[model samples]
Target: MTKAYDLARDAYAAWGVDTEAALAALSAIAISVHCWQGDDVGGFERKSGTSGGGIQATGNHPGRARTPDELRADLDFAFSQIPGRHRLNLHAFYLDSADNPDRDQIEYRHFTPWVDWARDRGLGLDFNPTFFAHAKADDNLTLSHPDPGIRDFWIEHGRRSRDIAARIGAALDSPCVNNIWVPDGYKDTPVDRMAARQRLWASLDAMLAPAHDPAHLLDAVESKLFGIGVEACTVGSHEFYMGYAARRDIALCLDMGHFHPTESVADKLSAVALSISNLLLHVSRPMRWDSDHVVLLNDDLLAMAQELVFAGLLGRTRIGLDFFDATISRTAAWVTGVRNMQKALLRALLLPQAHLKTAEEQLDFTARLLWTEEVKDLPHGAVWAEFCARHEVPAGTALISSLNAYQQKVAARG
Candidate 1:
């Protein structure tokens, strides 16, 4: 350990916080890193089309992975820079196979390469069904489409996705979280929102009817407020999925970018934890809307980590990142986002919660406030540096040269 870390540890110990315990806790929490950012949400499926269903990667940034191998290479480098053993969050369309197959026809064998790769690296995998970027979803509808045929196609895709997730989890000895998020809504005001929701309800029920071992697969549903085309109405609104997940006793995914700009996802954690057995967080930085910007070490992110630690919700919560920024180096984006998340979590773990909670319980609001603000200026950076050093990962400016070199290497993909 460095002298700085020792000093920082002693300082934290003065606050009745065990820095060693906090570091151990931080190491145990794995952040599920999304793979879409490596290639701007472009999957490797043959005959893939543009992402039209409110999903768009807005940049001509070079080095975008064109194949599954290239994407995995990028992911491999990205994971090296991160400090912990994390999981990979994958979309269904990111399949790897020699033969072409539609979404509904996909099988586990198609994704065996990914499973094998993850297994070799001792990593877990989570999954999502691609509900957009196809002829079926061209109208910004899928599960809730008015046409029965389209609905059936997406329902089958959902079923296939769950099976794939189960197989992946079983292979890796981890429970894969299968999350479903559809871009089903209306650009203009719809005549009947109820009809669309009814169809969605039926479609989801049919898709999730088959049961899988909870040890292998955990199902989650994500909600969105609005999207590029779906401005007026989003069929699967927060309220809709909140109730659905509660009734079905499944996980509810809360994306930071999916809610209104002013809303606090941190506050919703404790409230939603009461209704659902599991909570999946899609951690993203939303500017004014669902911009999906790279996460930073900002107040919003810190508040979320604080809530997860203080509320004692970490055990039941699955932390997953959801951001796609094609504007910068893709691997660098992953490293920065994932590292920032870890930093936030470490800071939360280092908090003197016992003192704060005791003060709160005793109605000493002044002491609570003082301590809350006081902990903000603690030596979190020193401890975080030690963590990166222990993991043999570069910290701060050292990563810039590595990212620059990788960018230069991949720039030849033209």
Candidate 2:
């Protein structure tokens, strides 16, 4: 160890925190890097569809992947730059096959390329059934449409997606978290909210009725507060999915950008952990609204890691990134976001959590406040530098220089 890291290590050790254990634990927490970031959520589907979902990636950055191969190459570079082994969160619309099947006709073979790729890299793969940016979803309503035919079509698509996810998980020997998030909502206030929710309830039942090995496939439902057009009401609100997940015994996804600015997802973790068996966190930065900005080492992100580490929820919570900023280098965005998340987790692990809790329990508010603030000024930077060094990844200006070089390499993309 360097003199700096040795001193930092000794300092943390004095606080009754095991820096070595923290580093080891931080390495094990793999953040599922979203594949959509590489291509700004534009999947390689061969159909004319409007990108009219609540989600939209702003700016026309150079080198946005137009093909699955290109996206994979970008992902490969992003993963190489990020420390620790991580999983790729794949969307169904990113299918790679000559069949060019519609959503309803999608099968397992369509994702064979991705599975093979992940297998080769010793990385686990997560799945998402894309329920937006299509002709059927043009109205911002899907799976809960009034027309039975449209609902049936979406239901079949979800069923096939689960099957594909199951096969992928089985192949990789990892449970694939197939998270479902739909844009079924109303721009203006609707009179009959009950009807739409009823339809959605039935569609979800039919879609998830097919039995799959729980060891291979895990189902999760994601909820949103509001989308661009769906400002009045989102069909799958937080309360709706929280109750559903609790009743159905499935995982609930909590996106950092999907809630109001005042809300603290960090506080909800302990409460939600009481109701649900598992959780999937979509870590992102929300700029005033759900703008989906690239994540940074901000207060909210730090609090999230603190909750996970303090509450001992990291084992049951699957951490995934969900942001798409096309204004910057996509690969740089990925590397930055993932590394920030790792950094936050590392900081949490290095905290004297037990002592802080004891202080709180003993009603020693002064000690609690003092200890928390003191950690902020500690030589955590030295420990983090040691971490990046051990992982053979660059930091500070070196990282920026490497990302700039990569941007130049991919700048020729039309």
Candidate 3:
């Protein structure tokens, strides 16, 4: 019998990822940039110094602060890097430096250059906004209170964002500063959370009701753990006014990395599929402690995510890499993660629709349920060994060489 991996290899190899077509698929591309190269290596398409709430490539890794010119050069580099025919879009997330010349300057001078750079790359500016108000050089800041300083900081921050929007709209261009994440939702008490929620969506309300074009929408990202409100933040969105947001056609950003043990992947994707106006795709892996490892796909999580995509639950979704590369330099991390993700995606496209259907259909509730509950705790080698033993995949030294050769062939393209 032909195995799934063989099918995946064949399907992906022949898969028509026409460059021009792929470029057209991007609503935005959340890019990962490094400080060390500055404007070298042709820069990046979405040349931001950061990507996620904590994925500050420059700070997390060792990179320098780029001057605007260098940043522009980086943009040019990225623009030229993608084949003009390929469909690569941009979503720029500028790491709003607290040390910059006030909120106004950061928005106008610091961030705008990159926004313009995005245009040069045939991209758009759909930022995730800044992550909370407070400044912390500590990983220990997770789930901490919204520092008073941070809250006030964000207020002024939002104002500056509004200024930039006016500038972009005045130019008749689309300017979106997406506010989809709240890193400060961890609290212990059965707390009154309305005020906090209001602060989160105030700008979104402005966009939906009395603001500019009703087409201008904010994407809300829902999570399952490890931030304000321990269990306070559920897997799916539980905002203060979801109905109002929905009425406005406010969309949701579904991060595959955020689903927990209890949430049914099928159920969640179906729900997200309905809200297309404001969709953001965040992909990552869940580790032993529920920590976001930002690892490769095939993590079982993406298997579930793929099931949704295959079912047409995520039609025309804009995907973003809200990932982290903690072990290596941020630049290298981008190359590794993005390359691996493409491989996983190709595998997804190659998955046997019939097999998946049969598995789901044939599954006894008790047996199929094991997939949702059982997360491997041992080293990956052992886990893979066990899985290979059960699934009957090609194993041993030759298998490693085969996979490596596959990766090398894919990587050597550029």
Candidate 4:
């Protein structure tokens, strides 16, 4: 394997690509893996009936983590199989509460265990305000709800979430990316769209008014094109959030699965980077709609990585995974999605960017096309294998056996 990597390294070197530098850079990147994937987005909050959040995890896959300990154990197993250190993304509803508390009343004490867990493992943490699947959101309106009392409830929840995120970051000494994504929209065209948006704008302003140290917390707002119930009009559309983020100078989250099926979220990276100082990408796969399937090393994923690399915006971007698949082993899903994302980044780093850029600058379009096609056939797999080996992780299909053994001995245990 070392010989193969040596040869591959020489080949990349000929293209003016430093394989060692690429590996070092890739190692420094930490993708935020969402915790919802392990438990099908089910939180410990006491909510009767099914989730009303316009989102649903469509499988009864056994072995879903029922407690905070189980979830942490599963996350530990998943992280072991994937190379590189990564952060964990959590929702406010996932609080370790014995007496299910209301969203607005949640305090940081409920999440101290998570902080301790992450601190002990040397992992960073990110957070989200759970604006869905709760009683306040039962009417499909949260921050935009006409009733001031109801709107205030959600606003307070958002505020508490940000404070908690700051605490997590302060405890770990790493800035936590606290993202806000509300499931407020209409199933059909509304008579007062403008009024609803106005209310939402005001609500956000109030929620984000309290200043937290930027060193400990970074704020972001996520938008979606549509969802299961909010088909006709989503209050937080892409245009809305983009404008708000630019005007407010906050990070904008570009969720891969939250856009139109025909639109490439990768293409929007550079465009959004122009206005927003920091960007957060919620990497996911969209099947027809916002299905939130496990990510694959497909063209879209590759394009996103290449765009980030080419634009030299990787350091400024927060890359995170946002998929949940319950049909397969949850731990396996986490490992597969995170590894595929790492693979995409590695492939992007292996590209002969200097040559390609020179060809384009010289107006040698043919040469640019030729080099692009040629690099695709290069021995990237060998380099990736070497990366995994260096990181002391299983390369290629070898991870499957480890995942299976873990499922039987740990995840599947009642």
Candidate 5:
């Protein structure tokens, strides 16, 4: 492995790319792993009847975490196989509450255990207010609901969510990214789109009225093109959130799966970064629609990583995984998604960006094209294996056997 890595290192150095610097940089970037993948998004909150979120996980794979302890244990095993230190992204519904409080009534005390869990592991935390899969969201409107009571209920929930996030960040000594994504829209065309958007703007203003220290909390608004039922129109459209984020001077979250099939989120990164100070990225795979499939080493993912590197926005971007695939081993899904994201970043770092830029600047398009294709065949796998070895994680197909052993010994117990 050392011999292969040395060869690859020399090769990369020939292109003026420092493999050591790349590794060090990659080690510092932490990807936020979502907690819902372990439980199919059925949060710990005790609810009656069916889930009402616009989102849905299709599979009923065995070994789903039944409790917070089990989920944490599963995450422990998953994180062990993945390289680099990562943060955990949590929804409010995942609270460790015995009293089963309503969403609007949730408080910081309910999530202290999670803060302790993250602190113990030396991990940072990110949060989201659960605006879906609840009784209040049954009508498919929240924060933008015409009813003052429903709107007020979600508003309080959002406010408390921000406060809870601040507390968690203060406890962990890291700024928590509190992202708001409301599943409010219509199944068909609405007569009054202006009214719904206007109401949503007001709700957001009220929710964000409370002042919190920027050092401890960063607020972001996420937009979706559509969801399962809200097909025709989504109140929190991309334009709405972009305008809001700019006007409010807050971070705007762009989910890779939350755009049209033809749209490249990679292309939007540079444009949005010009206006927004910070950006939150929910990395997920979209099959046709926003199916939220497990992320893979695909073209779009590669392009996104390259864009970040080219734009010099890697430091300002908050990357988080947002897929929930219950068809496979949950822990394996976590490891694969997180590792692939890291891999994409590593590939981008290994590129000969300087050479490519010089060629383009000199009007040598052919040379630029040649260099791009040439780097594609480089020994990136060897460098990646060396990276895994340095990080003390299973490299190559060894991760497969480790996951199998885990499923048999640990997950099977659940």
Candidate 6:
């Protein structure tokens, strides 16, 4: 069973206007305003090319797909749904357009514009560049995608994107980033140059390590199962750390919804903890191999949360509510879901740290019982355990469940 999503951590009523509420919600929370609707990191209005709302044929499509103003508007709504006052780690993946790189990637034309917007609102920044060389390099050949216009992300832009972060002053400081799931892995025996693909990120880390600043931020590697031959930017199910550690402050970006139904969340966390930075968690009734970032805690609440927590990922972990909205009213649904998560986090924070330690390290009990004991779970578990437990709930299940129940009451009203 998967983990039950905790939206209550996101939606509890603000205790007061003080910065404490904001600080409590800040590090543990952030969102990809656009991923709610697939990977249109630009949040562009999607219409057929024939339709006027579609991306227009232009030299630069800053306003063609979506405007910077529209993006800011979405975040404003996001901040409201999040519990208490907080900051943001914005995604600008749409900026990497065929026609324009800077405007489409992490910018809306000029760096100062985005900087001004965040500074005005007091939110921090995180974004990717269109030209970063992250794609699997096909220097000698051109590849065809089952889906048209989808560039070979691993070959073309993987390194370019990484390079931009090194060069850009702003990107270096943003709290977090999302690495595109480069679908370049070869299902066949003779693959494209694997060494080159590996080198792309390695070089990036080697170059940036000297310049990396903890204050500048970390990178989150988003993994995937299908799309491009099951071979994506994440490297593979195991050697995840090899690719991630290449970039300074970089970590694995786990999307709860990204794995196949068979893949256990607990197992995934255990296998990939060495590289984890933040979680791009998704929740929803899943289809076969499809990604639906919805709110589906009730489907299997206990198992989901338990696995996530067992893997040492829960409280104090940065969360991005990846939800989609078909209409403006859906914004309420998305926001409500986020609120539920925040409320659940509160319960997790209250969990006793010492008791969890014994069960997890000494007793070697199940992840479920590790936190249920009288004492709290300590922050330091065995290195191997830490590798697996990415969402360690600081607070206990009771607090999280109670707060979540309260939010359910609120959801019932709407």
Mind giving the per-residue lDDT tens digits that candidate 5 earns over 189-215? 899999999999999999999999999
N/CA/C clash count, model 4: 0
Compared with the true structure, what per-residue lDDT tens digits does model 6 show for residues 1-414?
Answer: 112212222222221122223334333544433332322333332221121111111122111214555445545654543544344443444332334442223323434455566677666555443322223222211122322133333233434444444334354345445344433344444444465445545434433434344445445555445333332332333355335543444556555555676666545555555554444444443456534444543433334444455466654244555544343233344455554554344334434444565556765687536336421232212211221123332234433454454334333321
Q: Report how far residue 164 has shifted in candidate 3, in Å.
A: 3.4
Whole-model Cα lDDT of every candidate shown, in order: 0.93, 0.93, 0.41, 0.91, 0.92, 0.41
lDDT of 2 by residue, 1-414 (tens): 799999999999999999999999988888899999998888989976785588889888899898999999999999888888999999999999988788999999999999999999999999999899899998898998998889998999999999999999999999999999999999999999999888888899899999999899999999899988999989999998998899889999999999999999999999999989999999999989777999999999999999999999999999999999999999999999999999999999999999999999999999999999998888998888999889888888999999999999997898
- For all predicted structures, in order, the TM-scores are 0.99, 0.99, 0.57, 0.98, 0.98, 0.56
Residue pairs clashing in model 4 are none
Clashes of 6: 84
**307-410 per-residue lDDT for model 1 (tens digits):** 99999999999999999998888888999999999999999999999899999999999999999999888899999999989889998889888888889999
Ranking the candidates on lDDT from highest down gives 1, 2, 5, 4, 3, 6
* Poorly placed runs, candidate 2 (over 4 Å): none
| Pairs of residues clashing in candidate 5 | 53-133
Residue 225 local lDDT, model 5: 96
Q: What TM-score, to 2 decimals, does candidate 5 have? A: 0.98
Instruction: Please list the residue runs of candidate 6 whose C-alpha ends up more than 4 Å from where it truly belongs after superposition.
Output: 1-66, 87-89, 93-111, 129-174, 178-180, 185-212, 228-249, 274-286, 298-317, 323-330, 350-414
Q: Residue 41, candidate 2: how far off, in angstroms?
A: 1.1
If both were scored by TM-score, which would come out higher, candidate 2 or candidate 5? 2
lDDT of 1 at 189: 100
RMSD of each: 0.9, 0.8, 10.4, 1.2, 1.1, 11.5
